[model samples]
Target chain A: MTSWIAGVDVGGGGIRVQVRTDDVGLKARDRGPVPRIAGAIDTSRLCGRIGELINSVVESGARPAFERIAVGLTGMPGLVRPAELADQLRLHVKTSSVVVASDSVTTHLGALGGEAGCVVSAGTGAIALGTDHRSTWNRADGWGYLLGDEGGGGWIGTQGIRAALRFHDRRDGGSEALLRKVEHQFGGVSAALAAIYNSPSPIHSAATLAPLVADAAHEDDPVARAIWVEAGRLLAESAFAAARGLPQTYSWGGRLFDAGELLLGPFRDEVLKRSPDAEIRPPQGQAADGALLLAARGIPAGAIAEPYVHEFA
Target chain B: MTSWIAGVDVGGGGIRVQVRTDDVGLKARDRGPVPRIAGAIDTSRLCGRIGELINSVVESGARPAFERIAVGLTGMPGLVRPAELADQLRLHVKTSSVVVASDSVTTHLGALGGEAGCVVSAGTGAIALGTDHRSTWNRADGWGYLLGDEGGGGWIGTQGIRAALRFHDRRDGGSEALLRKVEHQFGGVSAALAAIYNSPSPIHSAATLAPLVADAAHEDDPVARAIWVEAGRLLAESAFAAARGLPQTYSWGGRLFDAGELLLGPFRDEVLKRSPDAEIRPPQGQAADGALLLAARGIPAGAIAEPYVHEFA
Candidate 1:
């Protein structure tokens, strides 16, 4: 018997939630800001918010009770302890079982359904996850803004800002088109720096400029195109590393959705260079969709995935 | 005959000042943290402090009246406005002539003895400066810690910390020896993160660990050695760009002194590859000495080098 389930993508500013039921299929519910970062998560605050969200969904008669739930914390294993978080969240939501995992896991599950494949999620940060037919998963990179996050939206945006400043100063590696675009977007270099410094999330603030870079790429600006080319290569290389030569199919996911062949062209070339037979496909749905699959027991969570979201009590 | 003059390396934490006389050669007067970055400089406060320093030196019989003074502001040309700063300071100091320049220019001057050559100063940030025989100067990198500054102490330290974290997690590209060294250095990963997040100058805090990386390299840790190799190459490439293929000499300065050949070997090789006759030599004096040269009119501050430190009184 099919029953109700929910999937949540808890982010720094807010949480995006999706509810799925046998009769209703899948629908988005209310979204509210959670604490932030898988690592900086305030468990009590998050659990309380989860409880409120579940109550609102049920009180409004979205469903009588959720049979299962899945949560993809932005930083799962490294930042948030899946088992502990699952237990805390269970007390608030009515669920017989819950699956908790990294947002990367949800991305993979959502993009590939129950099929074996790799999903490379590139937003403010970038990470790659792959699973075999047996649902065993391997993950790579997402080292945040400093150490790594190569080729992600934030990386691109940062490069755009830096290049713009250099170009404005008539410094080397400066591009006129890029400088104009970044100046227009940021209202000037100092403003851009100010915004980044004053903002609560510098990474996300920078990521917002990725589109300007993407636009620059469209114009065939060599500087802009270079960033994308490097990004695509890095992303593909990282995703391939996670997949370990198994399940030759891959999906690209994240805010930099379908940057067209600009990103995909290099990504595809990089992947095919190694695997030759590798296929790059677009994800069918978002991470929430994958979370639903985990909730419905259509796929099992790996060791890092934390299959059980419900509290024992 | 040289008159009493002062040269100051206005640093982030404190001011390193040298009171120079025709007879004394070079004498360090006092040092106290002034400000961190160029943007953070408080003109009034700095000028007041400078006034006090001059008074202290005179009162202690170090000097009678300063005939000339040169101040090498850490981020003068880029982050700090040279003319405006010089004008503000002149109102407070007793000097007929004063010169102001980026610390990089002074670093080059001090290292090259007012001759045409390149100086790579890699401390909290990295920058290279070079001048042709005609005194036309060019600068490379030093784009601050965020944009660039590769091969600087801050960069090496940051790399060391990142490698340590990755190794601790047994993540991809981790080195066991590096991890052990990092853990011992920071007391643990959590402590390291705390130090970075809680510090006023995260960049400086990270830079503090560069010594640890050097130690690791001393023990032949692959990860630590790789960072130095990369750093050496980057510093050389940047210095080459600034030199414009003219000067065949280079002076490497900063806290990375203890790193020895682990850094200099690759740096020398890279520089020599570009300029086969290039000579790498130890710096004859510090930036303060360069400032003294500026004060004595021993070297003309290029158009790029603002040659006035006097405030419009």
Candidate 2:
């Protein structure tokens, strides 16, 4: 009997799963995130959903138990007990071992393909992690929207909206192009402001407007372009800061990089500017692929132990 | 019987009423703000509360109808219709005429003593209004905490906390003093951050930490002091911007100015730096006092007509 391995990427948007056995592989996604109860990961529900996703991805045959499973979760650190989550998974899926890690770790592995390097992942927020997966674990930013996440989507969107409002108010540094876009999207700046304030997740609200900024930047809007340029620089700074004791090899993962040269141009410029010998590479895969790699191959040599990467046998 | 006048200041903190008749004046306060329903002021509840406070401020006797009553409301501009509010006020208080003005207008009246100058009011938020009361109405930087309100208490507190978080993250520009204070106040920076994010009024939560920044600045913490300096400079810029085409005479209102030299020093420096002949005067009274002045003396000479200041007889 061929053994199967499963990988799960749990994020704010939803849950994605990958299954592999022999040379065949399959992927599936659930449009709902693991329900969090009062700041905690609902382990039972998460395991149940992970089981459903894994089953859906596997070919229709006699239901086969997975040999191992790995999960990269958004709110993993300090929010979930790995041992308990592993135990819960045992009840839902037939797996001999379970691995749990922060999405940052998975992102790092996915970006650098388990090689020692720095990876800055920016989506709704931004965080950089540098590790040899053995002893070093340097982190930068990811402080959320209020305090940090500086060069992330939330930051870029906020700057864009603020510039729009500046134009609306006829203040200096206002951008007419951005203002027109914002007015079209939110009816007016005041209404947009009100919507942001009243939003349950204000960070996401701000981040949702990031594409508008990118679009404006692409159109040669000076203020919007400046915002992206600054964002790239700030993200590079975070990468370098995280890369302190690590090698000068850097990469990035996350949808923010989807803007292509708009972000990469400045990000690459700053990284090389900071360290002339630095190497910048495109990501190998994604968080789910990294998680699947962990499940299929087990922990790589020099990978950090418990707390960062936990295993239950 | 000599006619009496009433002035009510409705703010986020609460409502305060001042009643004047003959040579005596009485004051009373209600610690609860006017109830808001679906983003609109509950005029009925507000009028009921205003009536109770007004009656409380008058000596126990036969209630004499007021000749005029002026209200300075925090959310008057768009949240409440002045005529509707006036009709509501008439039902609660036997007044022949009612005056309703934005807190900005009243703050201007109080700070400049009805003069044609500029006043910047900084509290939980900040705003600047410059009007001749007859024609000019140049306003600047009241865009709330999200977009504007730079240099306001909320802005100061946010910058302070951000520095603290940077320290916690071991990032550049971090302040040890601020980190220590934040940890002391909120047990930990992460906890403090969670609280702020979970707060219904995140701006107020940030503003509440302004005193900590102020204290740290007083202790000569460079980061905290720099924040205040920038804040003062920003406020001054707003003041000067509003003062455009008007007299360079300027004054300030709101408890934020109570920081005294810490704020006033940089504020005055920036104001003078922007305009050599600018005059910085101490505020003559509070917002309520301006509302009272409006009620007693009616609109000042050359004071701009309706919308800015409304009178229903």
Candidate 3:
């Protein structure tokens, strides 16, 4: 009865936390933004803050003897060192054991409720992680914006801007209407150009256009529609690449995926076309819930995807 | 006797100056590197240096009342302002008919010998310009490295690095050979990643791989060969787009084109496939000679291409 377990999902928009024990099913809370992968956030400061937040959520002593704590954060080990994060977390959080990982790892666990499957997390960036029943896992894309990020918002937005520029240059004369949509999205073409050309962190700025692209697509702009179509194909391609000869329970998760059918319709079509056995179902819970399952020792050792796990203890 | 008509073709590698009159044409001088477009180059200082070099070649007193001077400088009006060059030139020489223009326009003038044709200036960058018999002009794809530069060295090298990284990820099952080539080129896989991901001016750094990619292509690496093939197709597409409805005198002129048949064979096939009438011909003269034509009023007004012209006087 004294055992306590918790999970943390740290993302760009904000951080979400969940705590649970066998007697108590689950308790959850939502907070403001966390340090992004590599942008303006400091990992040490953020980790210490996360430790404080965990205490608040559990409503326990200053140093709760938690049985286990699992954290899924963006920028783990890629843009930021995983060891730095683990060392900082150990300094701040008092727990018998604490572990951190990529948000995609906890995503698959929470979304599938521990049943083996694949998940395509499409947000500012996109990554796909899949594990077969045998517990072997593989991942595709999500190499950040520089390398890849195929179907993510940043990718889609960049593609849209490229199309709009081509239309301005009269490459695709049919893209004039899309150009107007883009001009309107950024106040004007000049402003958009300035933002795109002059910005330091162009990925974040480009992602600001995702909503405009979605609306234009819904409005039947051929260029915009083409953007979503290619996005669907690329995202699915990433998923198929990661599925690695296994049946996949595919769940598309991300803020942009919130476009629902506007985005998922094409994504689903593309995913099913390649993997006829893929189950294009909705996610059962958010990433935080998956973290909760990890905290409570719900995920089996064999089923734990090692490719994504930065830490096991 | 004091009148001199001269053209200057300023590019990344070096500067070429051609001095001539109706009775005599002096051979052009190839000097050291000039200011490159969009790199760490100071325009005013470079312009003064160009002026000094021009005077030396003409064998005339400083501030000689030259009949006409036309300059084709890289980055002018794109990375550097045309006024900056003109103003700086005025400091070193006295010429009422001095005109500063983009290297691309001067390239087309020089390569075609003032004929109506498309010139694909392929180097660290790529730009295509075309003029019809009616004097109407069109340009395609020279938006620098960020937005475009599809067939340029930067594009080819970037694509190669991407392929190499994919091989590093073990994504391309058949890319082992290409990976070794990339490792050898960049001193190792780790250095390659650091150069690609950490360099401030990654375009220039990535372009350094162009030669390595060319060698790998010749060695029969499928991935490397694919890079060249795609480069050829994209460069040709840019030419075709610029040619518009007119019959184009297509000339591919740049340092990377120095790969001779290794680069041009595939490019020729692609260009000829789309443009059967495209006369695959070598440049009649170098860019400095083309600028000399501009200075001497050799370019006919009827077939003049002004889209790339930075100055008219």
Candidate 4:
């Protein structure tokens, strides 16, 4: 009498699907690009893509047919009505039981075992999400890719490239190493110019240069290194916004919750410099897992030992 | 005996060469990518390229036997030492007479008929140059493309995209047009993600979106139009900085300078609301022509008419 459930993570780039059953545990996982409908994608079309992805998982010969499906979407704005979103999803994937939540909610649930803590996702976009013991959720600064996604990979990458160009233009005497590395990665300034001017997705091309920034930071490129530090500071600012008002009983989830340390070293240092008692930890799972747990009817309340119970294949 | 002279204008994107002689008038113009030397381009290399360009005009058999070369560079920072820059130029072309000045200086010279006034260049970069009747020069906010460069086409384009993205994330119901336009231009959110992630020249790519912003503004997109208006305000801020003293006069230069009516409509409105006596006019000639005027020895002060001369072919 075990129930099967599906979880969908919709992002700006694509959609990911994960299915699970009590008997087999995590069953099928798949990913696909969100299809564009009517020359553009709306809520209905996006939900349809999610439905199609869920159907694909069902069709993949998994037993104990799913009784419920849960979807976690990263791209949907917070301003949208939750009830309306739920209705939209029902239109595409007709099911007696379905749950929809913010991708941040799921990510936090997965990372901290559905506990009361915060999660910061800094990929192409950036946002900080936190939930209190009473399930009061709050978010700050996922304003989308353009306005502020500050301290995200894209921001770091963009700032890095801008610094390299500035150093190139000003010849500030000690930027040869940075310029050389950037030129090599970008195939010289001419190619960089063409890619920037003629190409459609210039930001994507620029993001590839992120590693160069990281490398320069390691090699002590002042400008490049400074950008990372600044990124860390910004990331911390976003995280601090989410961490406010959380009870002292809710400590940050361990190792898995601490991924922010990777990009927010300077930010953490700065935060610690300001606040001596800050609870930061590494996250154990991801947003998809959180969505799956929510689908399975688990409301994470507090810290639990070895919380994530997914059967990895 | 009507000696000829060549003026070279080097910008962030490309370089332009204009040769002028008394008999031939303004003959022979060429445009090409800025040349790089030694697999890279430094300040010295850029100066050398300017000299070589001038030498090309001298060897091209343009009559009246050119006696001097004037080089104007838009992207160069403040003058550390003019003598050193002059010495760098002497390394390439054989000429007894060579003058190197900031492209802004020449732009102002041409824009204000070699008299005392302010000149603002708002292109890929932004700067304001000014001089009093005593020939004391002043500059405000041309800090390359990284720190400021506000009010330029690049800044406006970047702001437009940012605003569009913000409006998208806000889900405030008034940004469908802008979101659609951005998605169409950048080839969907995934491509935008990739570009922001992978490119080496994000600013350049951001700058390329200027036309799209302009188009959106033309269509009366509020966010897009706001970007242009904001740019005008920022440009006006630069003009204000230059016109700090009493009874200030200023001229606008750069490609965006001509977009005065469109970009500056709101900006001028805002400026007049604050500073009613700010005299702003479009420049007569470009930076290259300004360089020629700068290089021309002994042309009595105030001989050149206000608004200088406008010749375009």
> Model 4 residue A114 lDDT?
61
For candidate 4, lDDT tens digit of each residue in B38-92?
3233557667666556656654654234466666664343222345555676676
Across residues A122-143, which tens digit of lDDT does each residue of candidate 2 receive?
9988998888888888888887
Query: Which scores better on TM-score, 3 or 4?
Result: 3
Instruction: Rank by TM-score, highest first.
Output: 2, 3, 1, 4
| lDDT tens readout by residue for model 1, B1-313 | 5578777777654666777676675454445665434445676677778767666655554435567777887755445666666676777766766667677766777888877888898887888777752546666777666666768888898888777755554445666777777667678766666677557767888888888888888898888889999899888988877777565788967667557888889999999987888889999887777777767663433433333232221
Candidate 3: the clashing residue pairs are A110-A290, B110-B290
- lDDT per residue (tens digit) for residues A1-313 in model 1: 7578787766543666777666675344445655755436777788877767656655465445677777877755445666677678877776777667677877887888767888899878898877763545666667667656778988898888777765654445767887788668768766667677557767788888888889998998999999999899888877887787467889977777557788889998998997798887878888778777767673433333333122222
How accurately is candidate 1 docked according to DockQ?
0.24
Please tell me which predicted candidate would have the highest lDDT against the true structure. 2
Model 1: CAPRI class:
acceptable
TM-scores of the models, in the order given: 0.80, 0.91, 0.82, 0.54
Ranking by lDDT: 2, 3, 1, 4
Error of 4 at B51 (Å): 4.7
Candidate closer to the true structure by lDDT (higher is better), 1 or 4? 1
Report clash pairs, candidate 2.
A133-A304, B133-B303, B133-B304, B134-B303, B134-B304
Which candidate do you rate higher for lDDT, 2 or 4?
2
CA lDDT of each candidate?
A: 0.72, 0.86, 0.73, 0.60
Model 2: what is its DockQ?
0.46
List model 2 lDDT by residue over B37-150, tens digit each: 876898888988999999877767868889999998876466788998899988878998899988888898888888899999999888888888888988887877766798
Could you give the C-alpha RMSD of every candidate to the true structure, in order shown? 4.9, 2.8, 4.4, 13.1
| Residue A279's lDDT in candidate 2 | 92
What DockQ does each listed candidate score? 0.24, 0.46, 0.28, 0.07
Better of 2 and 3 by DockQ: 2
